[model samples]
Target: MDTVLTLAADNLLSPLILFFALGVLAALARSDLTIPEAAAKTLSLYLLFAIGFKGGVSVSGHGVDGDLVASMLAGTVLSFSLPFVAFAMLRVTTGLSVVDAAAVAGHYGSISIVTFVAATSVLESAGIASEGYLVAVAAIMEAPAILSALWIAARFSADTGNPVDARDRQGLLREILLNGSIVLLIGSFLIGYITGEDGLVEIESFVVSPFKGVLCLFLLDMGLVAGRGLRSSAKHLRPGLIGFGLLMPVVGAGAGLLGASLVGLSVGGTLLLMTLSASASYIAVPAAMRVALPEANPSIYLTMSLGITFPFNLTVGIPLYLSVARAVGG
Candidate 1:
């Protein structure tokens, strides 16, 4: 109970969470605030690269463990399987079509890097240390959901269909598998691993020491994006879809908790696992969906995931997971 309260109180005051709230409030109140798409994309690249390099540096120093392998396997399984579960639930609960359902499902199955970063902040604030290889686990979780969504599209989409074409299919595959974000993230991680402390030294002032400060700037932009998405989605959102959006994270986190406990993860690691499960797709999956499932209403999935559930997680869910993981793991 003390741990829960501590986590909750600390999370409430975090800059990233506050920035996210600013976005939500601005959107809810119909503010004119916005972030340029190019700038937002650049920030995302920086974040991915910074995190990937840091993770590689940590891993290079510590070396991978058997437990890391197991966790990666678990992440892959969760990525591929969660979509089917989500698709079925969305179909039963909402009026979303099959393609839309699958697209949304893919988002849920995939991991959200922002959420992972936020969780990292939460855990670090509490002085809990996590393994670096979770970065690789995150990378593994991003792509499989695309395959699942495509499979669902082939099997169930109606004639009007998505935006995909034969020529774009190969490109889409490459994008899903080798998105610039993923490439940079993995590449930076490899560089860090190869160079270790010496390599990190060359870029330390830019990457390591200034990380949290940069995160604040990034979250400010994230706030702007979330607010816009929320404003765009306000009318399209319905009670049922919103319910699914909120409930899915809980369901995913519960599964992650069980998995994490079984794997005997550290408190920090468990929190991260819970976060990866709890996070809803907002970035990569949404872009992929915009390309592959254009018929699906962007306002519904993007808003619900980013505007609604994201705030919920940043403000409430991270602390909730930390509290729950400790109680269960203790």
Candidate 2:
């Protein structure tokens, strides 16, 4: 308990979190602070590429092994299955329509790359080591939730008019698989793997030195966006929705803990897995939901995921997961 509180304090006081809070406060106060769209996009790309490349470099140092394979399989299973759990929970807790529930469920099921990166930063600060292949796991975890959500909507929802046609499904699949973040992440990972230490040596100055600063800025932008969403979507913020947003991540983290234990992850790897599972996707899944479940309410899902869940994970969930991982997996 002491350790958990300490970690949480440190995390809350970190520059990243503080900047994020500043952005949120600024937004809530209707201050005109903003990161330009293009700059924000660049920051996103830089963070993804840096983290993915470093993960590959770490994999190069460690070499492929059974744990890597197991982690990937476990991640895939978690991604595919977690939405079912989330959907069931949402149904029990909230009066969301089946489509809205499924849409929210998909966000819970998919991994948030930003959250994963933040966890990595936290782990780094703590001088902990985890498998680099977890980036691949993060990538793998992005799409399966969409499939699960679509399945849920089709299975339970009475609305049949918006059924996705074959072409639409294909396009949605392409969008999921070819999302720019995923592509850059996987592509950079492969590049780093192929080039190995030599690649890292060449680009260390570019990718490593500027990483945390970039992340801080990106998260500042994220805070602004989340704040704006919350401010504009206040009407959609029901108690049940907010409760699910807080509760579901803990449930997902528990599932991740089980999976990580089964796969024999290190304390740090276990924490990363837990963080990935706990995170609700605001990027890939939201875009997919827009395409695949257009009838679903974006304000509800977006506010729940970004405005509620994202901040919760950043401020509380990651530290809590780390404490549990240290207690059990350490």
Candidate 3:
């Protein structure tokens, strides 16, 4: 308990979190602080490329085996199935319409890259080594949740109208599979794998040294976005919905712990998996939601995922996951 508290304290005081806090405060106070859209996009690209490339390099060094395959498969299964759990919970706990619930559930099931990156930073600070192939797992986890959400919406909605009609199917598939984030992540991973250590070495200064600084800036932007969402969308965030946002991550992390144990992930690897599972997609899933469930309220899902859940995971949840993973995985 002491160790967990200490970790949480340390994380809260870190520059990345502190910058994010600054952004949130600035936004809430109606200050003029802002990151330009173009710069934010560049930072996002850099983080994705660096993370994916590093993972590929790690895979190159470690080589693929049964564990990599098993973990990816497990992650996909978790991604596909977690929405059902979330949807069921929502139905019991909130008065959300089927479409809204499924859309929100899909966000829960999908992974947040920023959260995953934060978990990696935590692990690195602790001098822990995790499997590199988890990047691939992250990529694989993105699309399946979207698919599951669509399926749930189609199957259970009081209205017979499919959220995704035949006309929209091809475009939606392309959006999911070829989303710029996914493409950059997978492409950079493959490049890193093909080029191996030599590639990393050649570009180490670019991708390695500035990674943390870039992440801090990116998170500042995130905090700004989240704060604005919360300010504008507070009326939409009811008690039941807020409670769901708080509780669901822990539930998802519990499932992740089980999956990690089954797949025999290492302590660091287990923590990453737990982090991935606990995260809600503010990026990919939200974009897909806009296309698939046009009637669903963006304010609700965005606020739930980014405004509430993201902060919780960063401040409290990461430490909890690390402690649990160490206890069980050690």
Clashes of each: 0, 0, 0
| TM-score for each of the candidates | 0.92, 0.99, 0.98
**What is the C-alpha lDDT profile of model 2 across 215-290, one tens digit per residue?**
9999999999999999999899999999999999999999999999999999999999999999999988888888
Between candidates 1 and 3, the lDDT winner: 3
Best by lDDT: 2
For candidate 1, which ten residues in a row score worst on lDDT?
156-165
TM-score for candidate 2: 0.99
Q: Which stretches of candidate 3 lie over 4 Å from their true place?
A: 160-163
Candidate 2 yields a Cα-based lDDT of 0.94
Pairs in steric clash, model 1: none
Better of 2 and 3 by TM-score: 2
Model 1: per-residue Cα lDDT over 170-228, one tens digit each: 89878877888778888988888899888898998888777776677678777777887
Candidate 2, superposed: residue stretches over 4 Å from native: none
| Candidate 3 lDDT over residue span 1-330, tens digit each | 998999999999998899889888989988889999999999999999999999999999989899999999999999999999999999999999998999999999999999999999888888999999999999999989999998898889867355567879778988888999999999999999999999999999999999999999999999999889888999999999999999999999999999999999999999999999999999999998898888777888999999999999998999999999999987
Score candidate 1 by lDDT. 0.81
Ranking by TM-score: 2, 3, 1
